[model samples]
Target chain A: MKAQRIASLTFTALAIAYLAGAFFIKEPPLRQQLGPDAFPKTIGVMMLVLSLLYVRIEFQRQPVKEDDERAAIIGAEEKLSDYVDYKTIGIMLALMLGYGLAFESLGYPLATFLMFMAGIYVLDLKHWKRDLIIAIIASFGIYFLFRYALRVNLPIGVLKFLFR
Target chain B: MDIWNNIVLGFSVAVTPFNLFLAFVGVFLGTVIGVLPGIGPMTGIALLIPITFGLPPNSAIILMAGIYYGAMYGGSTTSILVNAPGESSSVVTCIDGFEMAKKGRAGPALAAAAIGSFIAGTFATIMLMILGPAIAQFALNFGPPEYFALMFAGLTVVTSLAGRSLVKALLATTIGLAISTIGIDLQSGVSRYTFGNLEMLDGLEFLVVAIGLFALSEVLANLADMRQAVMERLSIKGGLWLTKEDWKRAIPAFIRGTLSGFFVGGLAGAGAAVASFVSYGIEKSTGKHKEELGHGAIEGVAGPEAANNAAAGGAMIHLLCLGIPGSGTTAIMLGALLMLGLQPGPLLFQQQPDFVWGLIASMYIGNVMLLVLNLPLVGMWVKILDIPLYLLVLFIILFSFLGVYTVNNSVQDLLLMVGFGIIGYILRRLDIPAAPIILAMVLGDLMEQALRQSLIISDGSLGIFVTRPISLILLILAAISITNPYWGQLGAFFRRIFGQKTAA
Candidate 1:
């Protein structure tokens, strides 16, 4: 698909998804008056209108002649979608998932270390030993700062037993 | 008398050893952040937000305001020494200021900018002291319609935001609106676009987005360029002072720039960038030494710096009076207010006299502190470029993540931070103006609330927007403001036509 077409379609898909979500959520009793679904329905309608407008604008724009086009976009093959360093994105998502899962099990320091190490690697930091060491130290330091210095009791999870 | 009393109280509050230390630290760190190519004032303040939880609100605000103006001061350092502007407002400064540096007149250029900023900043603080309460009273009348019209005016003027492609700018704004809808709806208590995650209920944090877009993306852009850091041979080649002729030429430009900037800065939608551009244009059009403009004119440095600082002061009027932030940096400051559990409105003036006056008083002190710090410390700031990029990046990332997570002690917020970072990266790659997006997102909720409240009062009649006198005036002004740009273009067209017809 052309860049403009893809952008238009993506917006349209978002609009449709919003509407679909709004429709799927069950309505509440009249006595309740408002519920979880009410706001979504309103926003879904707005999104649909905005998306339709975007699509219309995209479709109406005339493609420039090859010779007349500006130099700004000539060599710029990447559009919005192409810019998402997906390798990093995927790795980041996985790290977040790991942190979420480990939050109640491995505890703050351990989970934070893992997340930071994974993030540094995912972002493609060149130095392995340095990045790993720095990530660990920083993560642990942050954990102590928040848990001890600020006195915000973080979830120790299963490690609560070990500390006891 | 009240203002004087407040200043004394503010001085008493600010004189605390801890608060004083923080103010110094804030400026010093703010300068560092400003000098770092991608991290602007918004990021600097947002990064400092979590740390303030430990300090008094008055002290935190004092420090944050220091960061805000200090960043502006630091911005010119990079623009003067290197061609790169550390802040968007300083982009214009590079054109002539860098030229001055190449001609070995960097000392005079730096001195002019610093002194010009000091003078304008002090004047602005006084203006704030006198005008803040009066403006606050005027802003008390703002309703939903007025706010909508004001935002509309702001959004429309963004076209003049020193960028190409109006379509792209609007697209950026729409995307901002879309991002803003991600959190739960306040009115109906329904989740709009949370995508089934409990964490998404709060939406993406603005700080994460700012850092990712402005800071991380900048790092990526810099890394793409294989050249090592740009630094120059530094030292005062001669006595660091402006010549008599330079002074004679600069004073007029300085005054003109300050006046223009003051008005633009006070207006709802006007900001430093526009003020700087207007000042530069005026100086070029009216200066006695026109030939020296692009070739190292001292007036060039004096006028734009004065204008930029004046505009910064002007922007605070809206923030203080109507609780409207005219720019991205102010929006972050507003968020900081919210985080501190303070509502900014006219009632805030009547209710929290100390908070309001203390902040005004702090601006005066902060400006003085900035001049003291910036003059002798220019050499230290220049030395910052020598710091290894890897170490600096690690520290920035570490601090940012720590700040985010520490705010709520929530792992969920950390995930949101990362999400915003990715979103920021995507936005930057597409060349969208990030400031409008952040500003729109911040204001979106308030805009909706205002709209809804107005409707309720009117019993569902939309006519309520224009029924009120203030609302009607605002609507007319918005209409005129939007049309004025086109009229300007039309006048230029007619001028061209008449010139050609007469010649023929």
Candidate 2:
């Protein structure tokens, strides 16, 4: 009922996807025996077969050992809350993505500062004053290091005239 | 005697003012990170590899190699003072070192550890100098198929040796090979898995993958379990001189541990942690202080500390000679080599003697620097441990992001890194060894190229792999490696049959 058997199932799903994609992959005709798709197709089939084998063995073995780290494969089948603080990871990952996308538009300083503050908060750092100063200092510190020291032309966003 | 010439050339390169400065910086950073609680040498090297992008390859490796052994010298600090092992290799140090610290003998414990590490470091470096060229010379005879076979054997052996479940580890390795097949096929100019996207044409960046799979995922996993660890400060009050009794007991342990660590760490897959454990076990069994094995015995601290540093020196052999990394940190160094357009194999030694020998020389000076730094600046080094874990975590993630971004100035690479990081975290959760995947990814194209080249040479006959003596021997070794893990189960089955026969 939970997320049990996700790995084998996920592997099977990906293999089928790969095989279907392999069907569409165009190749320029070549004289050598093995084509470009040959290696990937073999690998996809290998993955499919091994994943099926794993699933079969998993089902056959009853009373899965809790100590087995492999149990995370099938054992994630508990409740939704069982996923430990994954929300923080998801939020932080999204923030990083946002930082990357908005980097050129928002400037390195602005983007880095925002990301740092968000990261600190998500990581459960409670001192807002300290976090703010640290974030500002780190953002500018890295900016100067890259701009002057390493000499990379970073984006300036809306506040471009300051450097000029 | 012949090594003296190489040593001279090595000193000529390493003693350059710039290279020496980088070595000091590397050791300084390495000791700081090693003295920290969660961040160890692997993380230190991974986080720092990007900074060396601006330097020459020779200077870069001198810096990286400094960090490598420098961590070994510093790891003993945390174990002795805080009872927290800074790295996995130093875990054995914590047992006796902490007890000694509790008994107000931290100064002598620290001194013995430093002295033992210095002696072992010098010995292992000498051994590496003597042994490395000989191994590389032997490897010069290898052709493509032999390389493939040797790589295959190494990959399988290392994977099987690393984790509990063979299936998961193999799966990780296979996934890495598949990832490596992305981008245009180099030989035929045929595109395989580009998926009609121009960005995908370049395939995945190795640095991005490394950062994601190692640095990013580690942050994600640890984010959930963030808690403050208040380490009670232990002071080194007494003089640094070791008593006659301390030196008498510690010297033999240092010798035994250094020899054991060197050989064990020089093997294909055995690493420093294993070397230190074996050293501790050997010390306990064969020492004069058998009854004082755990309760603050000087040999316990001395032996493992020596083993820890010597093992690092020993691990450099494979990285320098055969191009295979014995552990995760060495894999990062290999990634750096690839980024710098330097292929690391026998030819590297033949082609770049100055680079190789300079690296060998830097280890000697780096260890001495570590001993000097640890003794005088110990108070400053221990302060790094008190930095909030959350801030450290933020810094690591941000640093990783900046490093990947600057490498190519590509947002896509950043996205891909986060994706791989998540995958890495899942693999960690599933207990699939990540080392195999990194090894396979690094070797994937070369492996495929070797196979194809072998076939072409034999005019499409696969028998070329078996007909060549070296290749055949390597393939046999590969088969043995695959079966090595199952030997225990097979032995159990045979014993059961024999026991039943006796009963009947």
Cα lDDT listed for each candidate: 0.69, 0.78
What is the per-residue lDDT of model 1 for residues B312-408, given as tens digits with 9 covering 90 to 100? Answer: 8877777777787887788788777777877677777888777777777777777888888887778788888775555555455556656766566
User: In model 1 chain A, where is the ten-residue run with the lowest total lDDT?
Assistant: A69-78
Lowest lDDT block of 10, candidate 1 chain B: B219-228
Off by over 4 Å in 1: A1-5, A15-164, B155-163, B202-216, B219-236, B480-504
**Candidate 2 clashing pairs?**
none
Candidate 2 i-RMS: 5.6
What is the lDDT for B344 in model 1? 77
Model 1 steric clash pairs: B265-B314
lDDT at residue A102 of model 2 (Cα atoms): 72
How far in Å is the alpha carbon of A27 misplaced in model 2? 4.2
